[model samples]
Target: MSFTQKFYTADHHFGHALMLSETACARPFASTKEMDECLIDCWNSVVRKDDLVFHLGDFSMGLGDAARVESVFRRLNGRKRLVLGNHDYAKANVIHPTLAGLAWDAPPAAAMETIDEGERVYLSHYAARTWPGQHKGSFHFFGHSHGRLAPFGRSRDVGVDCPDTGYAPRTFKQLVSGMDLEPIVAEEAESFAP
Candidate 1:
């Protein structure tokens, strides 16, 4: 019996035609329909009702525009998952009738079982200084180098890089014990990978 789930990984580069907040979207839209309705009203105003949003990837940029960003992520609420990045390979044949769920970059033991069980740790858009020295246990949240959230002067880590707009979304025990983040088990996730 262990029901503790409040994970969030950001990088909602939604449709991405361009113009993503150069001082809050300075006239740069060839499409993406106003950054997909302001990232679906800023991730449904900080995502609550059934929280569990793990993006950590581009989500869209092609593939017939991913059916208008999978119809606004199927009217967002929660329970979404996708680690497929690199512009989501033009959506790879869009499909997301059930909220959201996608996984790619196989072979890290098949992407570590597509994460479940209250998620002790596993996230990726990329950040591999060898992935904490070749897979260990839990804790590995990542996002393409928009990085900036230091605190690993010596050891144990719970990596960071979550921001899409004015960072707010939280949970995962307030993001790993409220910002004291230090959980990388096993090979110490390769000294916090990247």
Candidate 2:
């Protein structure tokens, strides 16, 4: 609930007109421009300039070029990092594992591990079956499913497009509050299918 801590978010798909279409995210906006502006405002309203933000991916699309992407980041609040998503690639299926390490505080990684609030954390644009130390209480945060994916064990999706997040950047505690985090084998994970 506090805005002073680190935050996670993704699937902004800024400038991607299709993001608001019914077949896509079905965002409540008349145009992509309106959606983009609203998302930025929501992000800044919660995230402070010094807060760390992990953007799980699809940060930009349909913006046309790197400069536009860079410009968008400029208007955004917080010191940001990226976990590259599928649509975040340059030419080939390239937004995985690692990036050229430019613009961002570090390279845009497909996945990576870090420490958060004294707990181990795994970050990715896609969900993982069993992250390192999950049974030991580590948390895996991801995006790209746009809220369709089911959370397993301690994993969660931080995408803003997800109705749960309400287009705002949320702290890890805020993201997982009230959820069952007890250790469970990945084999017992819930399925989206009936």
Candidate 3:
């Protein structure tokens, strides 16, 4: 495989018991085990081993054991790169830095620019009103809101909890094709209205 395809997702929160609780994001899983299994299955089904996957942040939480965390990472498919989330600790980095590929701990709301499908994109754990290259047609992908927030301008939530994403990693083509940016534009315009 040429590994040309790329996917993006975030807020898996693996091993976090709260994720399955009614108080937290209201994830559909009945237990942590079910959530973990379903997330892994969904990821593996869509992402090949040779494909690139950008995990925006919050990969796992509540699994204090290093070995357990690493175990979960081992089962996920694709070439994983991480933009560290609030839940990702230093222990995670020490346990499997190489496995995470180009990992970095980005401060909340910081923007990292990259090109996808010949267009610029700003990757962050939180969405922003505007980012670098926004005037030049750059789009933003973020997690952390868990789909609680609406998309703004060219930005959209890529979190697993997003209703449209269905807890799976989404490709650039899927994003472009599936997202209706008209609503976002209207929302932005509404925000600026008096």
TM-score of each: 0.28, 0.86, 0.81
Q: What lDDT does model 2 reach? A: 0.80
Q: Where does candidate 2 have its weakest 10-residue lDDT segment?
A: 94-103
Off by over 4 Å in 2: 1-4, 93-102, 185-194
Instruction: Look at candidate 1 and tell me the lDDT of residue 151.
Output: 29
Q: What is the lDDT of residue 78 in candidate 2?
A: 81
Model 1 residue 168 CA deviation (Å) reads 16
Name the regions of candidate 1 deviating beyond 4 angstroms. 1-4, 14-33, 49-119, 122-125, 133-135, 145-194
- What is the C-alpha lDDT profile of model 2 across 101-179, one tens digit per residue? 3357776777878787787889998998777887678899999899998787688888997767989889877888866
User: Root-mean-square deviation of each candidate, in angstroms?
Assistant: 15.7, 4.2, 4.6
Which residue pairs in model 1 clash with each other? 6-172, 21-25, 121-139, 132-189, 132-190, 133-190
TM-score of 2: 0.86
lDDT of 2 at 144: 88
Instruction: Give candidate 3's error at residue 191 in angstroms.
Output: 9.4
Clashes found in each candidate (C-alpha, N, C closer than 3 A): 6, 0, 0
Q: How many clashes show up in model 2?
A: 0
Give the Cα lDDT of each candidate: 0.49, 0.80, 0.75
Model 3 per-residue lDDT tens digits across residues 104-188: 3323223456688887888888887767766556788989988898877678889999888878999877776655544334455
How big is the positional error of residue 93 in model 1, measured in Å on the Cα after superposition? 38
